[model samples]
Target: MNTSLEKVLVNVVDQHGAVYTVDAMCERSNDEPNSFGDCIRCINIDDEIIKPSLDLHFHSNKTGKVFKLS
Candidate 1:
């Protein structure tokens, strides 16, 4: 199986509806890495919900314009 690496911004919610977001780098083979689950288990982040950021962006030094991180 080939492994892939990706950078993602994940949003996590707690039981109390409190929201927390984290930027994570993940590596996966055959299946996507469970960043949200790992974040919940390893960190103190809440697991009420997990969603990928739709507007994830990065700036390029050459273009000087913001581009999606996909």
Candidate 2:
């Protein structure tokens, strides 16, 4: 029998219900170590792709929890 675990990716959702996979996040910044600018950039890209009207929020893949945006 073959056994393999499926990959679970994080997802971010916008107020309009548009969903974006975290796998699509941008690569890390080599110039700035430990900087989250890349993540924000990725979010912008995802936003452009998903085009959600309202503000965006993060959705936990492991916990299946949706965090509301203020």
lDDT of 1 by residue, 1-70 (tens): 5766566565544334545565555555566445433422121122222222343333334433333222
CA RMSD of each candidate after superposition? 13.0, 12.4
> What C-alpha lDDT does candidate 2 achieve relative to the native structure?
0.39
Off by over 4 Å in 2: 1-8, 16-22, 43-70
Each prediction's TM-score against the native? 0.34, 0.27
Local error of candidate 1 at residue 54 (angstroms): 26
Candidate 1 lDDT (Cα, 0 to 1) = 0.40
**How much does candidate 2 score in TM-score?**
0.27
Write down the RMSD of candidate 2 (Cα, Å).
Answer: 12.4
Model 1: colliding residue pairs: none
Q: What lDDT does each candidate get?
A: 0.40, 0.39
